[model samples]
Target chain A: MHAILDADYLCHLGFIRDGAPVVLPTLYARVAERLYMHGSAGSRPLRCAGEDTGIAVCLTVTHVDGLVLARSAIHHAINYRSVVVHGVARQVTDPAERSTALNALINHIVPGRAADSRPANAKELAATAVVALDLNEVSAKVRTGDPNDDPEDLALPHWTGVLPVQRTYGTPVPAGDLDPSVTVPGYLTQR
Target chain B: MHAILDADYLCHLGFIRDGAPVVLPTLYARVAERLYMHGSAGSRPLRCAGEDTGIAVCLTVTHVDGLVLARSAIHHAINYRSVVVHGVARQVTDPAERSTALNALINHIVPGRAADSRPANAKELAATAVVALDLNEVSAKVRTGDPNDDPEDLALPHWTGVLPVQRTYGTPVPAGDLDPSVTVPGYLTQR
Candidate 1:
């Protein structure tokens, strides 16, 4: 399983409103099994699209940076990477399918979470929507490492190096009113 | 200073090529301050007759999922929130001004790391492109806590609660073949 590079990069399946696709940033998750996402079968936009328009899906970008390293000026390069995915999402109309998909997404966030919390009842199920898409046509672009210094600059006295950039999560400050004894779960503490 | 509620939303900054607007993601950071993102210089789309058009951006997002308590279904209501800032972007062209803007960005990612790393040299500066935006037009949305079930399911008794999602960082794995005795820094340990 690939580590989730960033939470903001999570692609939560969404439809084009009026015209363009709308992606929500917090949809990214990591799973040992196939990654699952939210798609709605009855979403107003999905149901109205004609055959020519085709099933629509969009991805959300969470993080991007143009890193500039220096030794000399001319050898500079833009060191960056990103995630992109394309898919035709179909809303899962069947009840059983919705429940399973929701669980998969919950587990997609953290395995065993669905069990610890209650499963969706009929109404809750209806309240939620699930968009299903084949886990294909996905690609990730990653770039790392240091500045590309010219051979001539190798002996220069000036400093040269990479500026490390990454996302850092703070201690999970539980809901303010949460009971003090509700220990910070081990999974969260691991961060 | 507002937290970008959702960085997944994409918008056209200006006209480029056919209809493309240099398609960039919604990922943003408020480096100058937590919420001082006001950079609106002009109004609406900066259309440039025959020349390329640009935008005056000054927006951001904020998502906050508040605490919720529910004894059973129907009694549950979530307390969550998020924000999004959509607007045009401005290119920081002035030499000194551009440098200041970029340095803010570098420090935003790593507190003291910017000071610790080597500064960009002159030739390197020309290669880097920097953009600034304002925090004017924006929106935020949120969802939180338990599911609303019919009054009947409350007595049926399946454990009911909220599932939280979080992010984590793993131990930093260094590049191989380096000195093994290099001590891990305190900043990393805090991470």
Candidate 2:
């Protein structure tokens, strides 16, 4: 569960439309047992959510931790943690839930961000669209540790190990026109 | 074109099967005008590619670069570079091409890795599958720079800037069972 919450908020969402499969990468936030995805009113996936019959969608998030190098190419792999959720997505039309869901999305990316940022105004809320999916039929998979090699190949004189992949935050780059008097916030330094 | 070539080799592939859409994350390679995805012979997406009629698929890769913090929550966004390809995928049956594709896939993740590791044996080749898709319909979208905030909200006394996201390679961890004499290769240090 911590993997699901701590991993990046980006996800790949897939659904069928017009007899063909379509997939897009989008931002997503989980609030309790529900997940919400947001976009402008004109986005194709968001439009599909508004169809009379809700869209059946699959959303997935993955974190590649390291490359598992083995003596044989056949056994080479990546150690990763991933989550997959299958559900029917419907457009969120209620104003209150939309605000809450949007806030969750914002905070999920950066904790305490929702309180610092100004809430959306009525016009902005009307232009933005949110889709909600119940987190049912969800599964998480994780792989770790070093490469698994066959006994015979272990003596084949090849380097074997894990090249760890890591993500970090660099210095904050201010907007070109931002006021120079403004200082970086405390929340941004936590990461 | 560079975006497609430089992105991480992992991608989310989407395809329709039995009137339902399925999506999965897999390793992929780009050789000239074609993109190839690899997996075990029994994988569902690879199996779908073996059908008489090619399977319609969408493949996507994304790199999130920053958190776009805005004065208003509605304007908050992520800076990212992404590529999406829509095409029909077919199983690669030619043995020579399969071998080349497999090598490309391996090298895409780590340069010179294919040359260092043992090539797949005949038995291993028989148990692996490769799917190829032409890079005909592909589009890349990128967002960079600072947050986009409304003029009114720019003066809202909230921090506004971009928290740059970065990925780095950490020290390699050798397999517990690796030979004590084996050393980390120079290729791993280039990262």
Winning model by TM-score: 2
DockQ of 1: 0.12
To one decimal place, how large is model 2's interface RMSD in Å?
0.9
Per-residue lDDT of candidate 2, residues B117-137 (tens digit): 989999989999899999999
lDDT of 2 by residue, A126-152 (tens): 889899988878888888998888777
- Model 1 ranges with Cα > 4 A deviation: A1-23, A26-36, A39-55, A60-82, A144-191, B1-51, B55-82, B113-117, B141-191
The CAPRI quality class of candidate 1 comes to incorrect
Q: TM-scores for all candidates?
A: 0.59, 0.97
Candidate 1, residues A1-191, lDDT tens digits: the string is 14433344244334444433233433433333334445343556446332444455544343433343344533333344545445565555677766676665554443444554556667656655555555465566655666666665555443444434444444444443344555655544464
Model 1 scores a TM of: 0.59
B75-132 in candidate 1: lDDT tens per residue?
Answer: 3333445554444455556777666655555444333434544566766565455555
